[model samples]
Target: MLKQFGCTKFATGEDFDTGELFVQFEHRGRMVSLIASSKGYAAAWLKENPYNNRRKGTKADHEAKALEKGGTAVYSILRDWVKGQVTAIEIGMLSFESAFLSHILLPSGKRVIEHVEEQKLLEGK
Candidate 1:
């Protein structure tokens, strides 16, 4: 979807130990990076669909399965989201910047969301 929208560069990385993954792409001369953690998704999944002690071997086993499911789900969801957003951008319903503002990477290697979060925290002080 990104490539179809003039994204020329693409990269992906994962932390096997942490189940953290990131996808980066260059669009309209700006780099956008999005990160997701299988573990984090698993946690949320567990909350929505809690463990079934009667069907599982152990809690750990159930958690492992959830992590796998969440990992797959995250990619599928991300793909659909990117496709929809890109379509919206193409149709003039949304701008790329507004669609991916939080995922945009700055020269400092931090995401725009991180700066926005920091500013919000400072404002609360």
Candidate 2:
């Protein structure tokens, strides 16, 4: 299964890391997960590999690599998936990039910014 999924050992931190982009399948009474990202290294390795698996080296190394590559990949995949799902549901022109860049209105009538605002208020101006 590992070979079929193009599984490779990542030299990550603290433990062995295995990245898998998997799909759930039912087999008899049990559920099976098949690696879908075997065909796409960047998708599977970059996105799903870091957090889902154990690291092989130090935590710092794992975190560094994950922060450098994993985070971006994960964000990309998640953004794409969200876009696809929302579009499928006929949500008009919802863009992940826009949401990431600007403020968005939530269903709760609250506005959320992609990044937090840090402001200091003076007692008297």
Please report the candidate that would top TM-score against the real structure.
1
RMSD of each: 2.3, 17.5
Which residue segments of model 1 deviate by more than 4 Å? 121-125
Model 1 alpha-carbon miss at residue 68, Å: 0.5
Instruction: Give the per-residue lDDT of model 2 (tens digit) for 1-125.
Output: 32222223211121124443433322222222222222243444546665444667775665556544644554456446534643543455644334222233334433343123322232347
| Candidates' C-alpha lDDT | 0.85, 0.39
- Stretches of candidate 2 exceeding 4 Å from the true structure: 1-58, 89-125
Clashing pairs in 1: none
List clash counts for every candidate, in order.
0, 7
